[model samples]
Target: MNKCYIDGSIGQCGHSSRSADKAAASGTVMDLKKDFHMNSGAGDNSYARNSKIQGLIISKSQSERRKAAVAAYLGTGRPATMSVADLGCSSGPTALLAVEDIMVAVERACVELHGQPPEFNLLLNDLYGNDFNALFRSFPEFNSRRQGKGLCFVTGVPGTFYGRLFAAKSLHLVCSSSSLHWLSQMPEELQQKEGSPAACVNKGKVFISAGSPPCVAEAYRKQFHRDFTTFLRCRAEEIVRGGLMVLAFMSRKNREAALMEDRYIWGLLEDALNAMASEERIDSFDAPFYAPSMEELEEEIGGEGSFCIRSSDQFLVRWDDDNQYSGTGGEANVTARPVKHAVRMAKGVRAVAESMLRSHFGEGFGMDDLFCRYGGLLAQYYADSEAAVTNVVISLVRK
Candidate 1:
C-alpha cells in the first residue's frame, strides 16, 4: 500500500490515478478520512502553536459566523434542541472558539424570540489522525469559560468533511475555517507515474506557480471542483432545509490559481528546493492545495444546486497579520524584521507541510537547511513590499 503525507501526518493513500473515474463507477473513490491533519500536539512546530494566523483569519469572519448561526436557528423555529457541526476543527485554542460563538448566537436569537435556549449537540470534525485527544483535553476549560446558557454536548467526530458524516436533516449549522482549499487527493495528472519520464509535470514546485504548465492549473481546478461539489452534496444531505453553512478558506484574487498571493510563498520554497536539486528534493513532489477564484467558487456552488449563496465576500490578510513583528523605524530594525517574519512564516508552513516534505524527500534531506534558505528567500521577497493573502468567506443556505 502506498502512503501519503497530508498536513504533516502519515496515512495510507487510497487514491489511485483513476480516482475520478472510479468515483463515477462506484459512487466514491478516494477515502481521505484516514489522511490529512495539521501537525498534532503542542510541540514547537505543532499547528497548535503556529496557527495564530489562522485564528486571526477566523476572528475576521466573526460577524458572518454569528449571523449565519442565528439565521439558521431562527429558520428552524427555535427548536428546543439543535445540532451543530464544526468541520475541520483542528486541535488548538481556536478549536472551540467557533462552537462557543455559534452557541451564543443561537441563545441570543432564542431570547429575542422569547423561547428557551436549545441544548446543543456540537460535533467537531477533522481527519482521523488529528489530535482530537488534545482537543478533548481542553474541553473542560472551554466549558467552564463558556458564557452561554444551555446544555452543550460536544463530541469529536473523526472523519473527512468531504463526504457525508451526519444523518439526513440532522444538522442546523455547519462551519469550516482554513480548510476546503485542500483537494481530497493530489491531482492525478500531477502524480508521479511509475517508469514515466514526464510523470511529474509540476517539477520543482510544491503548488501552482508562474512556471507551472497550463495543464497543471487545469488539473488543480478540476480536483477542487470535484471535491467542493462532493462537499456541497454531502452537506445538503445532512443539513436541514433552510440551515446555514459559513465556510472561510484561502482564495486568490486572480482568476488564475498560479498568480495568487500565497502561491508566492510556495514559489519561494520551490527556489529553495531547486537550489538543492542534486539532492532530489524537488522530484515528484506536489502540494495538494488550490486557492480558487470567486468565479470558480460561484460556478461550483451554482452547479451543485444544493445550496443558495446568502453572502459572499473576499478579504485580505497580511503575511504578518498576527503582529508577530515589532520593529521600530530604522535601517537596523527594518533589516531584522523581515528575517524574523520569515522564520515565523517558515514555522507556519512547516506546521502544515513538513510531513509531506519529509515523506516525499527522504527524512535525511536536511529540512532545517531547506527552511533556512526558504526563510531567507521569503525575507528578500517581502523586502520590497508587504505581503498579503486573500481569503473568501461565503455563507450559504441548504435549498
Candidate 2:
C-alpha cells in the first residue's frame, strides 16, 4: 500500500515524496526512519537497559514537565479530551518515563480543581525502526502503575519529528526528552558524494572533532538551526495556540565543548576507531547529531516565531563512569570501577549509536572491537576529566 494512517490522521507514507523533500540527509546514504533505531530487544546491552543515563537527564526536568502539562491543561480550558505527545520516544523505560511524568502532573492539576481528568490521548513517536513491541510489552507494568491518572490511550506514531505528524492544532502538550539534538538529516554540505567538488571531508571522525575544519562545525550548526526550526514549525501546527511544549536534549556550554575537545562522546569514538583502524582507513562517516549551546537554543526559539520561550534551564550530568558512581576519584578511585564503568558506558553508547555506526560501517565491521576500544579511551579520559554533558531543557508555548 502507498498510504497508511492510524486513528484517522497519523501521516501518509511515500518514499517518492520523502526523497523529494531534501531539507536534510542522515550522514551518507541512510534513511533515518529505516537505519536509525537504537539497538532493539531486551538483551543485556540493549538501549532499554542502558538508558538510565537518559532517565537521569529526564528526572532533572521533572518539575518543568509537570508545569508544562498543567499549563497546557489549563490553557486549553481543561476540555473533556486532551492530547499529549512524547516525540523522539525511542523504545525503553525512558519512553514511558516521560509519558508518566506528564500524566502525573496533569492528573494532580485535575485533583486540585476537583474535576475529572480528561481522556488522555497519549501519543508515542519515534523513527519507524524503533522497537514498539518491546516498548508495548513493558506497558502492563506501566499501566498498572498509572491508575488514578486518567483514561489514557497510547498510540505509536512512527516518523521523523522534523516534519508534521499530527493534524492542525491537535496536541495540547508536546514533550520531548533527550532527543532534539538529532537532526532530521545530515547537513547537505557534509553529504556530498566523494568526487563532487563541494564534498566536505570531515575526515577520520564520526562527528566534528579536534582537527575538523571550521566548515564542518559551521555546516552542522546551520543544519541544527534548519532542522530545529522545522521541528518548531511542525509542532506549532499540531499544537494549539498557547499549548505548552517541553524539550530536553544534550547541549554545550560554550565553543570549546562544541569543538569535540577529545573529551566528547563522538570524539572518543573516533579515537577508538582510529586506533582500531588507521585514520586513513576509517570509513567516511558522519553522525546525524549535534549538541547546541543554550544561547543557540534561545535564538532558535525566538527566531522560529511560532513558539515563545516561557522558561529554560541548563544542567550537567556526568558520564556514567564508575569512579563517580562510587565516589572515588583520582588517587582514591576504585580502579575496577573505571574498567567496569567503561564497559558499561560503552554499551550504553553503543545501544544508542550502534545503529548509525552499523549503517555507516556496514554489517561486516567489528562492533565489539569498536566499543571495547571505545571503552578503554573513555576510561582513560573520564578518569581524570569531568567530561560531563550539558543538558538544556526548554519550556515553550505556542504564540
Candidate 3:
C-alpha cells in the first residue's frame, strides 16, 4: 500500500509549504503506474460494465480514426505490416473497438490501393494495474469475428503514455479516446499547505472548478502543459514521419477551466463528501485530471513542433444519454424519475472513480453511502438543468 497523506496536516496540492519536511519524514513518491486504472472486472462497479459513455466517445470519433488510419496507410505506401497503438485502452468491450476500426480503415485502403490488407500489429496500452486479463478474454472472440481476413496480432503494453512506450519510428498510427484528459499525476504545486486555514488549497474540490482559486487552475494548466508536451515529444520520437495520430478526449469550450461542465461533476462529488462528514478525506486528494480547451491543445501541438493538426472538432455529450435505468415504459418517463437518473449517474461515476476514491479515502470510508449522496446530488442538479459535456477530437500527422 502506498503512503497516504490524509492526516489533515497535508494537502492534495503537490507544493505545500511543509512538503519538503513531510517528504523527508515519510519517504513516499507518487507512483501513477500503481495508482491509475479503471476499476477491474465485469462487476456492477467495474469500468467494463459502465463505460458506455466512453463507447459513445469512441463512436463520435470514428470518422477521425478511420481517416487517420487511411492517411497513415496511404502515406506509408501501404506497408506490408502496419504498426498501430491505442493508448489508455482500458478494460472493456470498447477496448478492442478502436483496433477493429483501424483494421477496417487500413483494409479498405489496402483494397483500394493494393489487392489485399497488410498484416497488423495492434498494441493496447494502459497503466500497469489495468485489468488486462479481462481485456484479453475478449480477444478470442475478436479474432474469430475477424474471419482470417487479415493477419492481426494484438498485445497489451502496460505503462504511462506520458513517456515513450514504443521504439523510435516503430509506429505508423496512434490513437487515444476518452483519455489524455487524465494528467500523468497531480500538480505538485497543489499539495496541502501547512498551517493553512483549509486542509487544501482547492478546498472542497477534487478538480478545478469555478470555485477553485486562480492558483489552483494555474497549477493544473501548468501540469497539463508539461505532461502533454512530454507526451507529444515521446510520440514524435516513436512515430515514423508521415504517421498519423487521432486523439479524442474531454475538453471545455470556455477558456476559463472553472466554467467547464467536467468540473461540475467533481463539485457535486465534493458536496457529497462534505455531506457525509468526510470532507477531510479529500483534503489532500487532487484528481490527476484536466479538460483542456481546443486552443490549449493546438498550442501544445504547435509548440511541440512534431505534429501538424489535420482536423479538429468539438462535440457535446449529455449525462443522461446512456441512462441504464430506463424502464419498459419509456425513455422520457424513466429519465423523469430522479432515482433512475441518480442510479445511472452513480454507476457511471463509480466505474471511473472508485479506484481513486478508494485509494485516497481508504477502506474505512463507506463507498455505498458516498455514492448514494453523489447520486442524489446529481439527480438534483440534472432536475434543475440539462447541460451537456464537451469533448474535442483532433487528428494529427507527424511532420
Number of colliding residue pairs in each model: 0, 2, 8
What RMSD value applies to candidate 1?
7.9
Query: Could you tell me every candidate's TM-score relative to the true structure?
Result: 0.87, 0.87, 0.88
Instruction: Write the number of the candidate with greater lDDT, choosing between 1 and 2.
Output: 1
lDDT of 3 by residue, 370-393 (tens): 676676666677766654678999
> Against the unseen true structure, what C-alpha lDDT does each candidate score?
0.77, 0.76, 0.78
Greater-lDDT candidate between 1 and 3: 3
Q: Compared with the true structure, what per-residue lDDT tens digits does model 1 show for residues 205-295? A: 7678787888888888888888899999999999999899999999988887767777877788887766654423354556778889999
Q: Rank the candidates by lDDT, best first.
A: 3, 1, 2
Runs off by more than 4 Å, candidate 2: 1-28, 255-263, 277-283, 320-324, 327-333
